[model samples]
Target chain A: MDKKWYWGIIFFTVAVNVIMLQLTTRAYLGREFEMVLPYSIVGVVMAGIAFFTFLQWKKVEYKEDEK
Target chain B: MSECPKSRHANKSKNDMVNLVDNVEQKEDLKFNRRAFLKSAVGASMALGLSTVPFSVRAMMGLTDDEEDRVEIIDLDQLPVGESHKFYYPTEKDQALLVHTVDGDLVAYNSECTHLMCPVFYQKEENKLLCPCHKGSYDVNSGQPIAGPPQRELPLIEIEVVNGKVYAVGRQFRHG
Candidate 1:
């Protein structure tokens, strides 16, 4: 797969994580405990996806494409 | 011939050529590579995600707090309509206000203004809460910021009227 594809997923995760952190903090401040858990869970999942996508990209990036 | 200044790998070439036809270690590609950018993005996502864990932990802890404070503030009749009674609820440190709005609705909130923690007082005439220090204001009924520098609403104190007496049962740090 192209490296840019990995970047796209990673960027999306970064964006989602930003939103999740904001919502989690807001729910925490609001004392709405029920909402915080879901937001945090989503954030963690996105982060994991980003990490795996990065590892895949790493495998591709280190190998010189030119033969 | 002298090595080309552009290529750090120029000396590595078997021939002492001024400009190497090809170099394996391309400095420009190394400096601005997709791998480096993707690594940074992954790191940022990880950091952003992990940062919320603390908040989640704290929120879980906050949920366990009991809702049975049920401290009596004053007699319902003692607080006349369109008047306010100052009280300490749940704890003496949490200064709160129980307002009998002109519309005959009972509402309560922590008197500390959301902006800069200034004390907010009821303005019966204006029918709103006012922070004198910065002129911050909140809607009397909902505790939402209405004007001035305040951006967040005051913490609301949940109250219950039990047989001619008012009791504060719980506090919500944020609400509409």
Candidate 2:
């Protein structure tokens, strides 16, 4: 709801994306090819959400600055 | 310091907002530290889990314990020279071909073809191991691929005959 909370959300989503990407890479190294696609997709989705939240946080910051 | 009650209330709200922002920052820092620890812990555990799995699979794939290393496949009196006994050795996952050659030498080898992991059987009439999967043929004596798509030799299992019993002692694979 607040600008601070949006920043937290961005941090969490970025973390999720990073962890998912790492898991996907590990799965590849382990020869678990079946898992690679699903984890990569999840990581990508999380990254997208994180970027969207970052934009929203920026808009809120701009509004605060204008006030 | 004769501030109005309204101004005092506004000041209190501002202090609360600052406290909230400070709390969020503190929680973010804690989360970052916790995530770092979790990342390392997860990485270590994942590495440990992946590293130990293959050994367990190999252990399950008929690499039996030492006390049970000697597999009593068939009786020497029952298996005559030039005859072959198809059985499982060390573990059920491993198929073995225990053959008594015409020269009276007892030899055994893995029954899986090296080409595509197809099951190989002793063709006693032909005196060779034949893989019906691709018409692959292997030397019964040396377990070498004689005619087939296989480029590797079949793994050999060491055999021992003591008294009237035939036992498979150990196994050796061609490593290059």
Candidate 3:
């Protein structure tokens, strides 16, 4: 429920996404080249979800402080 | 744990408005530290997991072995004096090219691109081995990659002519 906890979750999610992207790129390219298109798309989706969740948590925390 | 009476007594007169704010800020700081510790643990484990995937896949694909030795023999007369032929070497999965150069010399090299393992095809007009995947080129005579992402020369398959029959003796890894 804390801001730090939410930030941790976001960082964890981003780390997982990066690991997945690296795996996918290595599998498809047989080398650590740039992230491929499909992996990039998935990473963007995961990051968007994390950002949206963080924004919603910030809004709730602001409302609680006002009350 | 028992609290020290001396320290407790000393703290009785130290209270201030700023200390209250400091206490709240300290609680947040502790939470952030805990979060950071957890994140590092998760990141390390995830990195370990990610690194293992490639090794596992390589093992499954038979690419994990350091030695991928192979040999093949082709007929000298069949190769002609200025032509080339594609042949599978010691392993069917490994492809190679036998080229009879314009100077009337026999040469053989692996057909897989060093960059990404794409199959390299002989381009007669250009007199080079071309990878369709990335447009990489290798010299037909020397098997040296001349263009594209290939950083190493194509592996040469050593050959010896025995009774006019070409025999691949060993293989050599070439790097620029």
lDDT of each: 0.85, 0.67, 0.65
DockQ of 2: 0.03
Interface RMSD of each: 3.3, 11.9, 10.0
Evaluate model 3 with DockQ and give the value: 0.03
Task: Write the residue-wise lDDT of candidate 1 on A1-23 in tens digits.
Answer: 87678878999999999999999
Ranking by lDDT: 1, 2, 3
Greater-lDDT candidate between 2 and 3: 2
Native interface contact recovery, all models: 0.78, 0.00, 0.00
What's model 1's TM-score? 0.81
The runs of at least 3 residues in candidate 2 whose Cα sits more than 4 Å from the true structure, single-residue gaps closed, are A1-67, B1-68
Docking class of 2: incorrect
For candidate 2, the per-residue lDDT at B132 reads 96
lDDT of 1 by residue, B1-176 (tens): 54345555445433223243364555656555655667788999999998999888888887898754789999999999999999987787878999999999999998988778888999999999999998989999999999999888898899989999999988877777
In model 2, pairs of residues that clash are none
Top candidate by lDDT: 1
Interface RMSD of 2: 11.9
In order of the candidates, what TM-score does chain B achieve? 0.72, 0.59, 0.61
- For all candidates, the clash counts are 0, 0, 0
For model 3, the superposed segments whose C-alpha errors exceed 4 Å read A1-67, B1-72
> Which lDDT value does model 1 have at B38?
70
Candidate 2 chain A, which ten residues in sequence have the lowest lDDT sum?
Answer: A25-34
- Candidate 3 per-residue C-alpha lDDT over B1-176 given as tens digits, one digit per residue, 9 for 90 to 100: 54333433234323232133335485556456543554554455345434444544543454434444434466687887768888776578878888887777788887889899998887767777889999999988788879999977888888888877887777666433
